[model samples]
Target: MKLPIYLDYNATTPVDKQVLDCLLPFFSENFGNAASRSHLYGWTAQEAVETARQQVADLIGAETKEIVFTSGATESNNLIIKGLFESSFPLKRHIITAETEHKAVLDVCKHLEKLGAEVSYLKPDNVGNITLEQVQKATREDTFLITVMFANNEIGTIQPIQAIGAWAKEKNICFHTDATQALGKISVNVNEMNIDALSLSGHKLYAPKGVGALYLKKKSPATHLMAQMDGGKHERGFRSGTLNVAGIVGLGKACELARNSLLFENQKLSVLRDKLEQGILQNVSNTQVNGNPTNRLPNLTNISFGGVDGENLLMSFRDIAVSSGSACTSASVEPSYVLKSIGLSDELAYASIRFSLGKYTTEAEIDFTIKYVREVVEALR
Candidate 1:
């Protein structure tokens, strides 16, 4: 049997070989507790960690001291939302975020709402893109923070972060964007955009998992956030516990490579994405694309095929690495919230599949998948 094709980049990504090379020394030869100050090994590890911090900062246009290493985007999101609220900053207690954010943000907001803090969830228009006007209307004089994701993982819709950030800046509200899906695939200049805080994951950008960075805008008054954990004084006491030296270094290298190669990679993936979308739509009947066409990430396509069950269609393409909303969330047996938000019915939402491309996706693979999908979709009908 041929090797299975992988297109579910939105879920996760494999580590790059270059990043792996940079991480190896930390696991064996140079292994030391970064927090231990008494020994040469410890100091060496600390230096390595700091150098990695610089690389991460360079990738996202932030200060070396502003990058806080954490477990992943989920942890970073928690730290940002909870820590900001808990900080001594003289701002309002209200938080504004979109309804389509990952469970990480949604759950945290729900938890905060339980604690008496008012939270406003702004739902985007049919294409899953939020408007600056909607944000302006939802925000209050007491609104302290506005957190929006740079891109949607399921539909690959890129948000108007710059406009939102500008509006938030004018209102003196702290703006945070979760760029986990956007960081590796797109260019994110936090300074030019006036983003107050941002989160990025390593694995999503071809580095190993277990490490991510939270970008804190320097001198933003929101820079000093409350630490979620308590232990050794690491990450300026904003995040406690000994640093993951190997993972951090890998993440830094990955960020550097991603920033350097973003444009070329996006251009390559755009062709494949177009082929996948156009082929499926032309070959199969009763299909529709989701999200803003030209304003989306270069490597993702979410298509809803009517009449056939998404799960059954997924089963037919057993060898391909595509995903159905039904398959990814099969444990729930419910329609996709993302699709429903964009005006798809329960059946259409259930029939949606997200095919996300990546750095290694090839023309032959796309051609084969398109052909296979056409055959399988027709057979299922």
Candidate 2:
């Protein structure tokens, strides 16, 4: 193991070479503002942007016009949350979001609260899942929005977006899902799911970083989004400023490949994940698996090693790439808000390890990772 075996796909994925191959020409010869209308370069870039938009739309059963490209998931999340408030909806002046939403969602809601909207933060079940009953009880007549993630990036649990979205639709509430982790890993049908809006990131799906999109439901005055950024009329005026043509093109290509081969990719990665999880539990002492094992993304596994510090474990695997579920706070170590919300103690949270598999993982890599992990944990003991 001369190089660290990269298993942090949930954090970010490597750009697919084939996607990069598609992106290379656009950087040099094809470079132009997709917004420009005067020249062949601009037309070429604009055409590519439209093609990529279609690719992204095809991934999640959205119309190309419904997809608004932005800087990344954070921007997408911000746009959706803020735009909902800025809209003319007769729904609940109250917003409902989960405690376990990405910081992007949580922080935005907090800010919105300061600006005078009431928000209810739903707590998930112990397995990191928000129940339909919980959501049903949370919705109010003025509930203008319901935002939840399609998957937990850290724990890898897939949320029931379709069920939640259906609940929102029945109440005429706008449903927005931060689907950054779900877009390429699993099937996302916005129509079938009854989702009003969804957010996604390019880096999460083997596309280059710094690019993402939000799916806006069409003709649905259910959502009236004011432009978040002021610039030339771009991204259908919801999001302004010129597009990052190269990154957007790369993102689109990545979406096309991921969409075409999703099932096969999930199956392959899940096998590697199961191997890693089984090996650790079989060989290690006092290790507890985190999250709902069955309802999680097939590419992820998080475990808590009793009596071992997470940083020590990560350092020991200086030869491996992984993350602790705990974040360091100024006064004390704060366990992952997601895990803590799901009821893990500080010690257990601090001891947690997350191994996320990805597009290029192999059985050989899993076997080697298992071997090294066992040795490291045993030595730590």
Candidate 3:
């Protein structure tokens, strides 16, 4: 196995070689503003951008016009949540989201709260799954949007988004999902789930950062979100700025590759994830896997060691790269809010480690990680 094994794919993935290859040409030879409509260079750039838009759209079962590129999921989340609230729709003064959602969504909700928007932050069950009943009970006539995450980044708990989406549809309320960590790991069909909007970052898959997309269903209420940024109307006035051509190209290629290989690759990842989880459980004492065991991403696991400091344990394994919380929140010394929201004590929350596998993760790395983690936890105890 390679030294300094990377098991933090949920944080971000290394851009795949093939994705990189597709990105390079857009940076130089085909460099032109996609908005420059009068020249051949612009035409080439526009074609590439449109193709990438379609590639991104296909992954989520959305139309190309539904895809609006952004800086990343944070911007996408902000655009949908804040934009919808700021739009001309009167009486849409409330929003609902889970407490376990990424800070992007959570923070946006907080910001909206200060703007006189009624926000309901639903807590998850012990297994990190929020129930559809909870969402239904929280809904009100003024609740214009219900934003849930497709998967928990730290615990890999997959939410019942399909059910929530259907409920939202029945209620004639818009539903959105932050699918950053879930996109390449599972099938994300907007139609199948009745999803009106979704936020996804390219870096979470095999593409570069600073490029993501928000899927806003055509002719849906979600498509009418007010533009957050001001400039020449780009992305159909939903977001305004020059696009990142190279990153978009990379994101498109990554999506295409993931669509082609996700089924076969996710199965392999699940086997590796299970081996690692099981090995640690059997060999190490005072250890528990966080989140629902069966209803999670195939390539992710969050484990908590009862008697060890997660930070010290992480420090002990210099040869392994992992995280104790979401990458955006890792620098904070406090226990993970997501874990705490699911009923874990501060001690257990602080003791947790998030290990996310990816397309490039191998059996050798999983075996090595299992043994290494077991030894460290035992030694620390």
Stretches of candidate 3 exceeding 4 Å from the true structure: 88-90, 326-332
- Can you write out model 2's per-residue Cα lDDT over 1-381, one digit (the tens) per residue? 446889889999999999999998899999998988999989999999999999999999988999999999999999988887877333436889999998999999999888778899999888898888888998877888889899998888888888998888888788999999887788889999989989999999999999999999997533487777988879878889889999999999999999889999988888889989999899888998888878988899988899887667767888788888877779976778888899998778878888999988878888988888889998998
Q: Which digits, one per residue and each the tens of the lDDT, describe model 1 over residues 1-381?
A: 255899989888988989899989999989998988999889988988988898899888888988999999999999999888877334567899998898889899899888767888988888999999989999988888899999998888899899999999999888999999998788889999889999888889888888998888888846767888988768888898889999998998898888889889988989889999999999888999998887898999999888998668777778688777653454667777777777889888878889999998889889998888888888899
In candidate 3, how many Å is residue 294 off?
1.6
In candidate 3, how many clashes are counted?
0
Q: What lDDT does candidate 2 reach at residue 370?
A: 83
Please state the error at residue 273 of candidate 1 in Å. Answer: 0.9
Lowest summed lDDT window (length 10), candidate 1: 323-332
Error of 1 at 256 (Å): 1.1
- By TM-score, the candidates rank as 3, 2, 1
Give the whole-model CA lDDT for all candidates, comma-separated.
Answer: 0.87, 0.88, 0.90
Best by TM-score: 3
